[model samples]
Target: MLQILGAAHGAGRLDPDEIDERQNAVLRAKFVDELPEQIDDLPEGAALAAELSRQAAAASGTGTGGTARSGPAPAGRDLAPAWKGPGGEILPAHQGTGPERTRVDIMSGSEVHVEPGTPRVLSYALMGGSEIYLGDVLAPGVQVVVETYAMWAGNEIYVPPGVKIVDETINIMAGNEIGRHARGDGSNGVLVLRGFSLMAGNEVKLDPDWRPGPAQLGR
Candidate 1:
């Protein structure tokens, strides 16, 4: 069980708080029946969880081969239905107004160039870094959510001129810095940033030199 949790954490599938909570539950279990039957937070961990339950039941002499104990599910196992987008893609927990583009970086670096059609951008960084560059001319009401997790992770958002940036990100033992930029009077829709940095850093600034051509801006 510890191995499974470790693997999930190392793969950036589970956050530090989740691993800590699950490990505490495992350590406090006095009997095999008290062990967790499933990792409810992990959408794809059902099979492994079931196998662990079956093995635990067999080892405790509560059931024979090919048979496992059956009872009501443990508390906290009931999760709300996941949010899905128009195309059936699962969205983040705090998705605001829905995002046209979602960029994720895990243990690596990535760059995302926002175009005209995309009004909302969701950028996630886990144990890695991500740079988001806003187009020169942004549509009205453009919003970007930059989330960074794990230690040493960072996210950078480059804002061009004539755009008002609204910072709404929460930082926990993390740095959230907004560099000086040419302020706009909200003519172009305000760029609202919303997300949290957990033991990480997120920087929002103006960069005037990065001008990527249309060919470089892939969907």
Candidate 2:
């Protein structure tokens, strides 16, 4: 009678339809990891791709309408400001550490050439009391170039934190009137307390990415 019971219990181990839920789950996960991901090299947007091609020319300040030259402005007009606001100060800040950490590192290199060079000119309108900050370290391994066009005399500008104003020689071929905009020296922390612009022309380059931090740790 004991042998009979033992034989009946052992029959369960011989069944071929038994399934292991844990083993199936592991196999599914491995299959997912082995699958290939699709990446699009050339997207459907022609506008953005054109900008990347002429990045080198823009940064070097050597492309069409890229230079700023000397000028004798009308009365009551002043040139670019070389300082910041009365109480302005440069601040240093970032997001987080480890996974949340971000860095702007632009792998310096020449981009594709702009054949027949039709460079886009930007127009921005900045009030006299407003300030501007140029940030470059949010993306990691990147550099940025900013440009502006004049509408009315937008002077008395103020530079904010994370801004490095650089007056580059990228516009050697641009006309004198077109070249007399603003300037910066490519420093780490700079303040532009004065400038002139129109509307919507305030553009900035992001070689990597950009991340803005808080002013200070609460009082």
Candidate 3:
């Protein structure tokens, strides 16, 4: 199958001399998903995807066709932020990367806030350093205590009483973190939430008492 695909790549257009040979070989390598009834010869799924790849490669001047000439997919599986999937597609595996930073000028009594639609992800990231607090309040909310090695996933950050999650998703209520305990390491293996979907006029808020604290390191 591979060799046959290679031949198609080097062949520019269909050669009358090799037409019969190429067609026979391609037909043999075709993957079986659906078989044509009554028709003496028909292409299969593998043949189709391969043909598309080939055409794309040829158009790009790769001079090759089908599987052999195909380019690599974008790195990062699923096309999500945290983890990547086969062919390097970024899949929705971790929390959103938002509210990149929240800064405040206590000295001048000034505040720089990220609108609720700013940052959404609350990565359980401790790699660059422990949870960071950048803004007006010394610590508007404590970092949610989580295990650096504990099990977790990326989804909605359920902010504690003192925190607010702001991302492209719906506005998380003040005093509450929408996505709590996100996975930073390999274990943040799933995509459970794509941000909050809220009703208009209704508000979301964190409980009056819940506070964030540094997560305890696990054994």
Most TM-score-accurate candidate:
1
Q: What lDDT tens digits, residue by residue, belong to model 2 across residues 117-212?
A: 112112233232112223322111112322343342221222222244444322222211211112322222332122233431223322112222
Q: Give per-residue CA lDDT, model 3, range 1-219, as digits (tens).
A: 223323443454334344334433433322221111111122322555544454445544565532333333223211112122335432332332334442222112222222222332232221121222222121211122211110111111222222323333333332123322222222112212223322211122222222222211000
Least accurate 10 contiguous residues by lDDT in model 2? 31-40
Report how far off residue 213 is in candidate 1 (Å): 11
Global lDDT of each candidate: 0.55, 0.25, 0.27
Model 3, stretches more than 4 Å misplaced?
1-47, 59-70, 73-219
Q: Which stretches of candidate 2 lie over 4 Å from their true place?
A: 1-121, 126-131, 135-142, 155-164, 168-219
Which prediction has more favorable TM-score, 1 or 3? 1
lDDT, candidate 2, equals: 0.25
Rank the candidate models, highest lDDT first: 1, 3, 2
Model 1 segments beyond 4 Å from truth?
1-99, 136-151, 210-219
Residue pairs that clash (backbone atoms under 3 angstroms), model 1: none
lDDT of 3 at 152: 19
